[model samples]
Target chain A: MEALFFEKLKEILEITDRELSANDKFKEYSEWDSLANLSVIAMIDEEFGVVIDNSEFKNIQTLGELMAEIKKRTK
Target chain B: MLLSTHHNISIKGLAVAVPSGRISVDSFYPSFGEDIVQKFSEMAGVKQITRSIDQQTASDLGYIAAKKLIIEKNIDTNEIGVLVFVSQKPDYRSPATAFVLQHRLGLGKEVICLDINLACSGFVYGLQTTLSLLKNSSKKKALLITADTSNKTLSPEDRTMIMLFGDSGSAVLLEKEDQGNAVFQFGLRSNGYKFKSIITPAGAFRNRDLPNKVEEWADGIKRSDYNTHMKGMDVFGFSITDVPNLIIDFLEATKTETSHYDVVALHQANIYILKQISRKVKIPFEKIPVSIDRYGNNSSNSIPLLLADHFEGKSQVLKILISGFGAGLSWACGSIAMDTKDILPIIITDDIYTQGDFKSSEHD
Candidate 1:
């Protein structure tokens, strides 16, 4: 699930050259933007069938947190 | 129950007009760099957009479309007893823009002239109000005009919006034909608590004073209090979750299914957003005609513009579902049954109401 999340994140964010780590502050990425944020939310929803609440999504900072939310929902 | 019903209101004709100035999304590559912009364009689903010149206003676009529709359909102008102009961008702050359009369109004082300050959800809401009024009154018809010059409100530095938003005006003619039991059903929703999700920080009475300095934010975009800002994350959640839920509720309440419609004229907000709505609601892609790839997001005008793009000049009957959601943090959907012969092909016009510039001073 983690690998799939990172892979999709990379693709959605259009981050080709660099690898995203779980600890990486995903929102701080140079490519990370409003479009990226929307894409990520959409990506999560599609991948995990989990609709992330707007406020909850905002509080999430790290890539690991996003993955964990998916984990919680999927489990 | 959020559902509202009106009977015997048939859409007589629909027309949309765009100003001659065209702005292509590809042109932004030079300023923002090729790679990122390409990604943005692909995600947002904007290729080129029709823009009204600075001298022109939203009502100008509305006027041309309304006139064309009136002339083409041979609609009796005198019978156009109600004119509702829906847009956030009005010509003047004082008089309702509908009154201006009413005068320009040769509508009389006895007519209903009003303005609705709505953006994306304008179409269904406009239809609900106009149809109800027409049904109650002795007047046989009401002209529902939704137009917006979104380009004017955008901040150049705010890349998220600059290219994605477009300008155009649309005119939908609703005739209260007391026959055939034509029924229109609508369900609308709003979240004022999340109103800040999409807002212009200044330039209104609430935020009247524009900051003298443009501050560079963490995103590196410089904007003052006057520019519009959209919280993409919040809007995405709203669009995918709230918007489709509203549609689903409307369908369940109305006892209709997504597959039942020949066309689902959803707002051309983004290609991704459109797809998400499709996935969430189970509406097929083929049934949803998109104009955003060519026209960008024309605010309230998107649904009608989508109709004019596909069903224009074609003669056929269609069971249609129209949904528009955004800005006001509002969303609405309506089921419409109409004949395609009533939908007019879009026309391009550069006409501006020059006197509106308000430049000349009286020699008193």
Candidate 2:
């Protein structure tokens, strides 16, 4: 699940896979704009059936945290 | 939510009038910069849109479409028993726009004219209302006009709204024909609690304290009570979830097979959101016609505008499923079938309100 999410995060953020660690702080990325946020939200909903609120997206800082939120909701 | 008319109310003719002023999405390059403009064009799916002139109002465009429908269909003014104008941007804040339209069109005194305030879901709601009124009544024909000059309500500097809305209007002739097909099977719902999700915060009475306060946000865009504001995520979430589910339920209630319909015309909101709904509903992408790329979101006029723009030239029998969701946080979905032979080409004009041709005037 972490690997899958890592790949999606890389694709959505337009970054190299090596740069996207599960513990990496995604909010620090310069490309973390509304489009990236919406794309991640859409990807999460489409792929995981987890509806991430915009506020939640803002609060989430790391890839691991986002995955944990998805897991928490999906479970 | 399902309502079916006992009397067959067929849409005999349909037409739309778009203002001559055109704004290409690419024109935003100087203001929004190339990257932001490109991203917005991709996100909003708006490539080009018709914009009404400063002097124009919703009534002006609606009148043009209505006049064209009346003339093209050869509809007698006296025979029209109902005139329903659906608009959120009516010309006057007090008197209903429909009454003004009735006088301008020179319809008889017996005609029942009403104005319904609605936005995105307006066409479906207006159609259902028109059909319900025509049912069991002595009236044989009704004229339904849906128009919106939503562009006028947007903040010029707001990133969220400026590029997303367009101005346009449509007129549909609904006649009770015994030979006509059953008009609509509808599902409509609203959540006023979420009304703030998409609204003009200050222009209305609720925000009378700050009716005209304009402030620049941190993003450097200036906005006031009069400008439209939207919480994109909320609107997007509601629409993508509810619209697709409502369409699925609507189809089931109407006993329609997914494969049987010819077109699934959802409101021209956003290409990404529409694609999301399409994927969720398992409907083919091609089946869902999109005009937002060309027309932006024309509010209430979207569906009829979609029809007049996309299906005007085709003569095939059209079995379509339409859903609209937006301001008022409202939604309406329905299945409708009609013959496209009566559909008229969309009229693009710069002509504003004119009593008659000056050259042909008897007084002249």
Candidate 3:
């Protein structure tokens, strides 16, 4: 599930050149833009069937946190 | 969430109007490269959008639509006992825009007037309010106008917004009839917590001192505080999650089935967003009437515009479900059944209230 999460993030954000790790701050990436952020949210809704709203999303700093938040919501 | 069904109300007439001026995606090729322009165009599902001219206000479009409906339907303006103007753009900050519309429409001095400041979700909100008020009042006929000139507040250089917003206004004439067509059910919710998700910081008194000087924003877009700033990601999350969930609940509460509706007219927030909502509720993509491709997202007017542009004032019974979401961090859904003839054809106008032209001499 964790591996799939990172995979979907990379695909949605269209990140190339650099690898995305669990600890990586996705916002710091050059590939990240407003569209990228929106795509990630949509990707999460499609892939995990849970929504992390804007306020909760602000506290999520890394790919690992994003995964954990989705997990928490599903549980 | 407020969920209730109102009876004895049928939309007697409907009309939507836009300015004759148009901004096509092809026109943006010079600012952004052709490749970028086309890519954005595909993403937004926008071919072109109508825009109001410098002298034309959102109210002008609303006035035109209302006037057209009255003239075409041969409505007795004296019978219109209430006027509800819902818009993010009003002629003045002082008098509610409804008063001005009332005067221009020649509605009686005793007409009830109101102005609601809201954006995208306003059509649903306005419909419910107009019907509820009319239900309790002595008069049975009322006019609901939802208009927005959101583009006027957007930064022209902001690619995120410039191509997405189109200005429009709509008028729905409602009357209580002994043999009304159908009941109107609405479910609404507001998340004031996310109010800042879409905002114009300096326009009002709180941030009155904020200058209009363009400054590099945190997102690297240069814009003044006066421009409407939208947190795209936040709103996207809300649109996908909160909006669709409420709509699903609304469907269940209203006992509306997939086959019940002839059309699912959604606020054209984003084509992808609309697709997500439809998928969640298991509504087919074909069932949704999409005007975004040609008209862009014209704020509160999306629902009426869809009816006007698609149905074109012909007589036929249709079951319609409409959902509008945005900007208050607000979302609402409503369903109604009515004859298509009441849904008048969309009109185009560049007319402005020339009497409103205010000029003050430097010496005065």
Model 3 alpha-carbon miss at residue B190, Å? 1.2
Scored by DockQ, the top model is 1
**After best superposition, candidate 1 residue B67: deviation in angstroms?**
1.2
Name the lDDT of candidate 3: 0.86
List per-model TM-scores for chain B.
0.97, 0.93, 0.96
Per-residue lDDT tens digits of candidate 2, residues B1-364? 5555444667788889999888998898887788887887887798988899977878888898999889988889988888999988887776798998998888888788899989999998998888787765687888999999888878877766778889998898988877744656788888898888888776656777784767885445788878888787788778778788888887787677778789988899889989998988899999988899888998999999988778888898888888888888889988788788888888887666654223545765
- Per-model TM-score, in order, reads 0.95, 0.92, 0.93
Per-residue alpha-carbon lDDT of model 3 for B1-364, expressed as tens digits? Answer: 6897899888888888888888998998887678657767876788999888877888988999898888988988878888999998899877998998988888887678999888899999999999988888888699999998888888888888898899999899999987744789999999998889999888778998887899888877778999999988788878887888888899889877867899899999889898998889889999998999999998999888888888884779888889999997899998987788777767888899988766675346
Clashing pairs in 3: none
Candidate 3 lDDT for residue B42: 71
Docking class of 3: medium
The candidates score, on chain A by TM-score, as follows 0.93, 0.87, 0.91
Instruction: Output the better candidate (2/3) by TM-score.
Output: 3
DockQ ranking, best first: 1, 3, 2
lDDT of each: 0.86, 0.83, 0.86
Consecutive 10-residue window with the lowest summed lDDT within model 2 chain B: B352-361
